[model samples]
Target: MTPITTFFRNLEAKCCASCGQVISEQAESYATECYTCQDQASTDAYKHYYKKN
Candidate 1:
């Protein structure tokens, strides 16, 4: 409602490290990436880890 409140809220906003997207407020405070990027990274890692020679 107030400008100061809005400013402080914006300060809490975070960006994803991999996709340059805004991280949701619901995400962990220490998260470095958005959920989408995190999910993609997890999928990639799973694929790589399970890949058969």
Candidate 2:
């Protein structure tokens, strides 16, 4: 692959917040969560932190 390709690939890659999976840079910049993480978060209520009584 060309250096430009590598650079763009690197530039476009991002790590997931929960699973540490590499996501798109656009997703990372535009969103706080990735696809997988967002899906999981939506289904898993326990994943969120609760306040103490």
RMSD of each: 4.3, 5.7
Model 1 TM-score is 0.68
C-alpha lDDT score of every prediction, in listed order: 0.78, 0.66
In the range 1-53, model 2's lDDT, one tens digit per residue, is 57966665666456776777777655327675679788877767554544332
> Which stretches in model 1 have alpha-carbon errors above 4 Å?
1-7, 10-12, 26-28
Where is model 2 more than 4 Å wrong at Cα?
1-12, 25-28, 46-53
What lDDT does candidate 1 reach at residue 47?
Answer: 93
The candidate that achieves the highest lDDT relative to the unseen native structure? 1
